[model samples]
Target: MTLAVPPTVPDPSVRSAIERLRQEFPELGPAPIVLVVRTCREELRGSPDGALPELVERLARQRLRVSLD
Candidate 1:
């Protein structure tokens, strides 16, 4: 028997949100994945290719909220 793994589908909401953010802030490069789960408030994951401080500030300004565990 072969076990099939389901393909990952990108969330529409997250894509839309990222698009909007990009439109607003083009300097942010690319928006990290933002997950809004029921249990948690909001989570931002993935690393941006750039300076750590700049990335942090950019994400903050874009309002991409995230919580670490």
Candidate 2:
């Protein structure tokens, strides 16, 4: 079963990286303050033509909070 995780702000590192990505991909608009758990991961899954997973990996490397059920 999947557990529900509370919404939380990204770490400073994630904020920084996301800001940079935001500038590069205006399609994403502003940097997100809160990560919506699994959906957030899905959003960053990246399109075949785009390479956003590398960017999301930054969060995974940093302190992006998450929980598994």
Candidate 3:
């Protein structure tokens, strides 16, 4: 029998970051913005939890902006 794993709940800050990114980069669409944010979150895995949200948002924003060029 296979055990089912529950979906991971995103951190509130991360969710907020995603929403902000969606608003800022509406032209890129939700999928790309989410991918960028998730990538940033993974890259920042070792960072202190207290700062992860802000750092993730900043990094994601920078990446999204660069993608525009």
The candidate maximizing lDDT is 3
Q: Model 1 over residues 1-69: C-alpha lDDT tens digits?
A: 122232266444344445555565555466232222100112223443334334434444434433221
Q: Lowest lDDT 10-mer window, candidate 2?
A: 60-69
List the global CA lDDT of all models: 0.37, 0.42, 0.79
For TM-score, candidate 1 versus 2, the one ahead is 1
Query: Sort by TM-score, best first: what order?
Result: 3, 1, 2
TM-score between model 3 and native: 0.84
The parts of candidate 1 lying over 4 Å away from their true place are 1-7, 31-69
User: How many clashes in each structure?
Assistant: 0, 0, 0
RMSD of each: 13.6, 11.5, 6.3
Model 3 error, position 69 (Å):
0.8
The superposed Cα distance between candidate 2 and the true structure at residue 30, in angstroms, equals: 2.4
Q: Write the per-residue lDDT of candidate 2 for residues 1-27, one digit (tens) a residue.
A: 232244374444344555555554454
**Ranking of all candidate structures by their lDDT, best first:** 3, 2, 1
